[model samples]
Target: MDAKQTNGGRRHFLKTGAAAGLALKVGVTAAEPRASTPALPMPEYEKLDALALASAIREGRLTALEALEAAIARAEARSQINAVALRHFDLARENAQRLSRMGRAERAAWAQTAPLAGVPFALKDLGVAMKGTVTTQGCAFFKDAVADHDSTLVQRYRAAGLNIFAKTTTPEFGQTATTESRLFGLTRNPWNLAYSAGGSSGGAAAAVAAGIVPAAHASDGGGSIRIPSSHCGLFGLKPSRGLVPMGPKMLEGWLGLSAQNVISRSVRDSALLLQLTQGPEAGSRTGPQPGALIDAITRPPRRLRIALMEQNPFGAPVHPECLDAVRAAARLCESLGHVVEMAAPKLAIGEMFGSMGIATAAGMLASVRMREKETGRTAREDEFEPLNWRSLQLARGYSAEQAFTARTVFDQAARTVDLFLGEYDLILSPVTAAPAPLLGAMSLDQPYESFVKVAMTASPFTAIFNMTGHPAMSVPLHWNGAGMPIGAQFAAPFGAEATLLALAAQLEQAAPWKDRRPVL
Candidate 1:
């Protein structure tokens, strides 16, 4: 379809379907779609996940170039979503053509060995840096900053034969729960254009949900992956600290709270991506001992001991829909033979929050300084959104002793979680305190205190796992009355991604969400 035709249809779909579906939760009831809408065959690559796409390409029914072109077309068709930060279609075309030229035997061999071979993927603009690409961390200052070499993680992604064709949007410096930046405008939810897609991996989430690709790169340093996955109805796993590399430029992100992974429709795709892209690169300070995540998902998990947190620990008012989603997931687990009981690790809540705040502030400040050094100039007020600028100013004033004490508190909390996990194999909770909020609800232009309040309230559950360095995933098992997805989160103890993936895979089997496509 032409641009005008695509835009008109998108407007109609967003208004008629997304706006109307708000009255009923998505998974609970079906909305009446226009009867006049004709059924069209979905493109072969768009219908297949990464593994399936590779299988088709290897079997000679589809070529790598065909898959790339299909994805590029979908991305172009979904232009109304505003998910892309930058496009690399020309470079991707080059790569796809080269891959297509390989002998049939060579292609088949690579398909069997390289998990994501010939799959088109988008890199989250936050931290999955590509060589010579504009690796903007959702900041205007970094818009012109190009990467001199591939990040260690990016190298691994390329090595797996995934074709990188685009970069997705993120919040400035990835400091917020929402994905709106001064550089890139809003990244809207695919399910409902009026709602958020979650961030700083919002662009990646939107792209995948809109079928631009089966999966895309994402990072979570405070729920960048899971939050967006929750909002967009995709599977997102934040692997344990040290499981994914931070790389040649840095050992850790946000003091090891950040992790790299992908947001995907299928559990096996996420698990396989983790298996292939995980492990420490050279100069790594911390990472878990490598484990077989892909293998673990091949079978159902044993009856497991699970602890369920039904309410927000910080006393934030969780939306009733989020609460209901967790309860339903808990019931599903019970029916599946897993034991679920109300439990949470005893924590010094006030101190942990304070420490988290301090550490977070310090990390943001450090990143800003690093960028200033890179650019060799001070940041202008015009270059940052109000909240980021204020946070940087405040964090700059934090004393070393204060930062150290915050780290100590986080460490203590981690230790407490370790002890708590000794009694349970996994913990279940709501990924966010609420569903995807309206645009500008969590804007960085809000006052600093208000921004923090919104950010913390929207993302209470996921950041704790980041601090504790546990493996956590947001499973899209529920949708609210407004048809917005509210994910149920599951976190396993440190270095136990295998357990989590197996359980996620089993859950996927029990309630298959693969066919649940968005209206827009």
Candidate 2:
């Protein structure tokens, strides 16, 4: 693809930063829509959001089996995107068929009780687990690591009656922003296949964008969910750390820098999903008291102070288009009666990056060591990505004292941001420094320096909230001249998801994005 076509058929260069590199070529699925064999008309189910789908099932307008089949057909038709990591179509069909066989009263009871009942969904092939299914974190070594039991979050999803019919792609251990993995290959953007579907939740974001599912699970450690959402044109939110459960397998994800939720075309789906899944699990940390998140979105938000920061906190250059997106979002907030200021927190970004490096490297070492014990052997070089290998190597040189000191730095950074947030109810920023990079821009096999540069450049704005355990979201408020989606990020204080949701809903009303489907 030419430079123009690669960036959604538009011409521009924003000085590509590097990340873990892509291992494959991106296709033209986005530049030009796919030409597939004209299959029979699918049920009109694909056009509906998750809540609408569930309501249809409950109202006897569609059977669960019929809905699942429609989604399966869409998934099969769009297989060229390489978004699906593991398909559960047959299993889902069987389960839905069983549900269809129930009495009318029973079916209504099931649908009424489960908010997502009969809605087709997918889990990103990372942190969360499903019993008896492969929980491969996009690594060859863990290819055989079948989950023995459902993670707490998965249990909640099941209870909500979401028909999880597939697992979506992620980078190895969700280590980078782009989703291409040596184990699962590349997951390209549905908007423009020549570009990346930002990772490590790229597959889920891509699948949802391609209309295979209305929503899919996504986890953000370092902008995984928001990055993909920004690239794929969806609503993605990362809950405050310690708010969402990560139990049965883990008490915390990436030392509380990670949180899991779903990427959806509609804000209500995301807000409702959080309402369904948010709360503590066994061995989980306490979070803010719960409230009706779905109801919160229905109410108009109070006018509040919002800071608009378009520059990179580390002094890296942000792309002009990305800065434009943030500015546009800020203007929209102003029109909505919110106070918008051009401001950012004063913190030592360099020091924070250094400390994060230490903590991440140590975490990678522990993960590799745990896998080593599981396999009863050390990790073979070929089994791990080069970027992850480098992390392991860097971790080997760090001591426990260094790790503790790094933790203190994170604490300080969080405190600093907390104080800054005291004066402002929200921080508005660009979700990424630029539009989605071309496939192979941040290959996993690339040198360590090139990879980190691209990764950081691509996602400079979203990770600080993760570090601070604050609630953050990427709302699809703008699309660049390239036609590539560029999301504006909004972060609120710890456990302030309701505020974020309310604002998101108001924005969704002012500028609807659900109807903006990609060509794919």
> Model 2 misses residue 166 by how many Å?
0.8
TM-score of each: 0.91, 0.91
lDDT of 1 by residue, 308-386 (tens): 9877878868888889889989999998999999999877778876777777677777867888899899988898888
Least accurate stretch of 10 residues (summed lDDT) in model 1?
19-28
Query: Once superposed on the true structure, which residue ranges of model 1 sit more than 4 Å away at CA?
Result: 1-42
Q: After superposition, how far is residue 23 of candidate 2 from its true place, in Å?
A: 38
Q: Give candidate 1's TM-score.
A: 0.91
Tens digits of per-residue lDDT for model 2, 390-413:
788888999889887777877787
* Local distance difference test, each candidate: 0.82, 0.82
- For model 2 the TM-score comes to 0.91
